[model samples]
Target: MVAETTLRPADLIAPLFVREGVTSPVPISSLPGVSQLDLASLRSEVAQLVSVGVRSVILFGIPLKKDPIGSGASDPDGIVQVAIRELRQCFGEEIVILADLCLDEYTDHGHCGVLTPTGEVHNDDTLVRYQEVALAQAAAGVDLVAPSGMMDGQVGA
Candidate 1:
């Protein structure tokens, strides 16, 4: 009790990994108890978290279809966007929903940014992609967008 630290359920932000086109939640052996959730499992897990007083969550999406431009990152019907809308409709403002804005998971090559003809990361081009992804997340009722791509000017842009 001597520690000057205060923690509550609100302070805990659950990180969810959601996979597109999955019929069931997939276990992530590397993450111990964590699993990549399908839409149904995601809803059930979030409900359980809310029942236990957790009021915040951030989502990462794994698209079944990855492209060079990571087009799914900004698609209104993308996995993350759909998940965000579903959560918002189910929980409304009772919980804070955040989206992890990045293209790595949606890119076939697993790079965080768009590539040049020489196969190098194109910074400026990737910024535009980030903007599109951010806008898409906003339109999906996300309370916050966490740009985890480690790109320069990501927050400022």
Candidate 2:
């Protein structure tokens, strides 16, 4: 009857993967019990999380369009931005929404940032992209933006 540590639902932050142009939730082979959800599914899932006291969530997006600049990463109408807007409209302030600020999922080469001609990651260039992403997330009503990946000067940028 003596438990040294206690775990609560509120202590957990659910991570949700959202894919563009998907009609149904697609199961992730690598992540057990997790699926890439569509817009409708994402909304439902967030509602469920709030119902259970899981008040925080981090969102990752799989965009339908990818480019060298990963333009979708900072688009106001991007998948993550769209999700944030929907979630905010759905739950208001009942839940905290955090976006996974990265370009890997949105980049054609799967790199976290723009690459040089020799295929090297451009830290300074990437920082500018990160700034764009941060601004987009902030405009989308995201409670926080967690910069993902190992880009230099990311947190400060």
Best by TM-score: 1
- Candidate 1 residue lDDT tens string, 66-145: 99999999999999999999999999999999999889999989999999999998988999999999999999999999
Error of 1 at 26 (Å): 0.2
Error of 1 at 152 (Å): 1.2
Over 58-117, each residue of candidate 2 has an lDDT whose tens digit, in order, gives 999999999998999899999999999999999999898999999999899999999999
Candidate 1 TM-score over all chains jointly: 0.97
**Where does candidate 2 have its weakest 10-residue lDDT segment?**
144-153
Tell me the spans in candidate 2 whose CA falls farther than 4 Å from its real position: 1-3
The TM-score obtained by model 2 is 0.96
Q: What's the lDDT for residue 45 in model 1?
A: 98
The TM-scores of all predictions, comma-separated, are: 0.97, 0.96
